[model samples]
Target: MLCANSAGRCEFDGCNKYIFYDNITAKKLNASNVAHIVAASPDGPRGDKTRSYLLSDKLENLMLLCPQHHKMIDDYVEDYPEELLLEMKKKHEDSIREMCDLIFVPKSERVIFFSPIKNVSLTHIDNQLTAQALLPQKRPASTCGINISIESAFDYNTSEYWSDIDNQLKRDFDRKIGNELDSDPNTIFSVFPLAPIPLIIKLGYLFMDKTNVDIYQKKRVPDTWKWIETRKTNSFSVNRIVVRAGSNIALIISLTAEINPKRVTDIVDADIIYIISAERIGVDAISSIDDLSDFWHVYQTVCDEIKNKECAVETSVFPAIPVSAAFEIGRRYMPGIYPKLHIYDDYNGFCKTLTIGGDC
Candidate 1:
């Protein structure tokens, strides 16, 4: 099933060479190699004495690859470690699974247009099937001219604006979508985000683990929109805590030592603080699994504390964390209860550019 979904292509990043080809003689040539994440032999590259006994021929330890990657990983085991290979295998398989699900699932004919931001024209959302528009109370003339009634609105300049209306937005989404889903559970949601990124992230958090929804973005091309897919899963098990520094604010727990606590504190004012040094640090980023696990533990602890109310959360990433880890943190947000994140970029010793988490 996995190989079929992959279409006989190599799973390595940026290496999509076909595994099989037809020769001029009409012969079907096979060039695929099943690469083991752990070496089959104790003396082989990335070899583990225990893994050789347990997973030497296990299918779970194998990944389909072309001859090039198979030889490359085996010859340069230190460069292509076991953990990295396992991550690659999981992502490739997940991509294939997502593609298959999209093809097999029968999507509902109804399309829900949820656009709070007043950036795109409503004509872009016109399509077959019944269409419903959810817009803000006072939007620009372009979006205001639509047939939908205004349900909500927010200030784009205010930093804490999302915090005030996060709950309202979630309730609005549930009230509207709940009735729709009751009629047809497979209804597709085509969201157009013209609001702050945090609100968009909150919109997604509302649908976490409940529905498969598609968000959309308007391209530079006039009157055009593109579908955005959510790939991160909401399932996570970790402990959370609250390091109180002040009211309605929390810090992103750092497991890497590269994040200077003093520098972070100087940039964002918060009532709560959670700080930790990395177990193993890198110059540009932290890629250690052990370190990421520690960070997740701390993140869950904080989530447990703040999963009950809307708060203004500030996160400062120092050194740097893995993209996957950051994404997992975003995915774990508990819908209406999750805080409005104020993400910062540490540039020249200042926490700059507050990016609210969202597709917009």
Candidate 2:
């Protein structure tokens, strides 16, 4: 019972090594030792006169451990006390049981997308990191990644480059994502997006909500794409700067990182320029789905204003945001109600703009 509960592993606090084989040699052997939490004799390590007599031969006092850990625990009785051993055994067994329960749970499919960012030569999303992020809570459907990235001419900052990428994304998404949904309409996807901010948005737009999708953002401090719980999520602020009142609206999104208004004003001329920034702006500003929903609340407010006034013919967007937020922006955008999006990317310095909602 003890061995089965411990999953045939060492029940030591820090060591859960399987004891079914020799550690050094490539040979199958049972290296398990059944140790007594309360020793059989009163003089033994952590021995008690009553417990040694009562629990010595009982299942409650037995622990499945590796040879090394079993010897160490018995030799160093003071360090590995009866209380500690009992706790460790319980924890190991409970964890193993939990894992067994998860075997029947359905797993989420991994979807990866990558692109070349200017000045940043390295753009790789390690599969292990993505897998680790989806742990005890969510399991991966398969080790194979549904890769949607296409080869390019390494030609950024050109019309041909943008044009080629735009078509490639649509084609691959149709082939990879569309075909999958056709076979099984109820598939769940966990999305890991690492691409140019504008392209990430476009990818989100193409993806839509055909299936249940989970968005992942690569964090800065804990340098991974896993979501962490912060003391507080992001709160946004909207600063309206109306240069002249006509029909043109310019939006500056500074959530993942802050941006200077002059950067947007210098190139694109607009009547009313909106600066929507997070109260605490940085890479880790957003922590959960609620945070992203909060951003949409603010964005929707701006949209409501635009729709109410009914003057703005088009909206120019200059964004310095996270991949998740950028993706959300594209996904949430209304092509019929909202005006066309003139997107200015970080790279290319205002050259070769990407157009969304106006792709007719």
Candidate 3:
């Protein structure tokens, strides 16, 4: 096979020809020279035949460059010292670090907060399924706006159509609902640090619950029910949340009306745990609250519950403390929130942009 390093076009400034092999043998003629995708010797030219970086011959690591950039690096080597080269390498490494942690949130130990699930509660809509356990017993007079769940909606074969729905939801939310809230993309869309555990795993055995879910994107709502035409098996639960490198972190707040004690006890199984960065619930729509403030509010609420009534709910946050704040916390729990996280190396390219529960 052709040497991958010499097979490609050069990225070095002002270079345009194919790069040659490294050996510089006489049989091949004295025509071409090797260019490093990353630099080797600072004193040498860009594609200097004399030098080799650590990434020289690995197929995924090499690049080809013409002679011009080779000369430029040779001339500029003194000005661009080793420190500068090292800094550049670190910058690229930092870019792809996926700031997410994925672990199973057993149904028994997940956090639950008390708040109206919708912005405007309609009695006519309330009457439709009021008898089921899924609906909240009493609707609050205030609105909680909308909850965005990036739960898995479909499989790979269904990807094209479902993605269209996802896009439409995004557009509708941005153009209409976000405008009314005075929110920009940064405020409306965020990374939910904790991912949902697969429903099959939580059920613990072969069981079924039929319910309706109204999917919301911004303000547009679409109704979906689980029991009508589909089935779930015990074997279907998944253990990981797909996260991509460098996505906005979202602190997912999952609320369930009925208190289940076993859920809180399941915190031990989580692979990544996070603290409440911030929270905002039960506030007026006009509050203009940010996510961090929202996190704090939720944190306070949890503390109050623990102090007074002893709520069984527990919270797990992820990506550990931000890299920027390592010194202050030093990998310790903010309070006694149990089951803290062990920060793994940033996620690989396998990271996903959204968390999709395996159900649909």
Best by TM-score: 2
lDDT tens digits, residues 1-360, model 2? 777889999999989999998768978899999999999999998888877999889988999999999999999998999899999999999999977987977788888888777635455788988887777568888887688775568467777777788889889989988888888788777888878887888887776644577789877577777777734477888888888767678888888777777777778777788889998887766777778888878988887676677467578888888888888877777777777777887664665357878663
| lDDT tens digits by residue: candidate 3, 7-124 | 3434343343445433445243334444344455533433444444554564333333356754554468675443443443334333223111111211111111111111222222
**Candidate 1 lowest-lDDT run of ten:** 132-141
Each prediction's TM-score versus the true structure: 0.33, 0.72, 0.20
* lDDT sort, best first: 2, 1, 3
Better of 1 and 2 by lDDT: 2
How many residue pairs clash in each candidate at the backbone level? 17, 0, 25
What is each predicted model's overall lDDT from 0 to 1?
A: 0.51, 0.81, 0.28
Deviation from native of the Cα of residue 64 in model 3, angstroms = 3.9
TM-score of 2: 0.72
Question: Best-fitting candidate, measured by lDDT?
Answer: 2
Better lDDT candidate (1, 3): 1
Q: Candidate 3: which stretches are off by over 4 Å?
A: 1-7, 11-32, 35-63, 82-255, 259-360
lDDT by residue (tens digit), candidate 1, 21-91: 75466666898888878878988877888887699878778888989899999888889998898888777
**How far off is model 1, as Cα RMSD?**
19.5
lDDT of 3 at 352: 21
The ten-residue window of minimal lDDT in model 2 covers 345-354
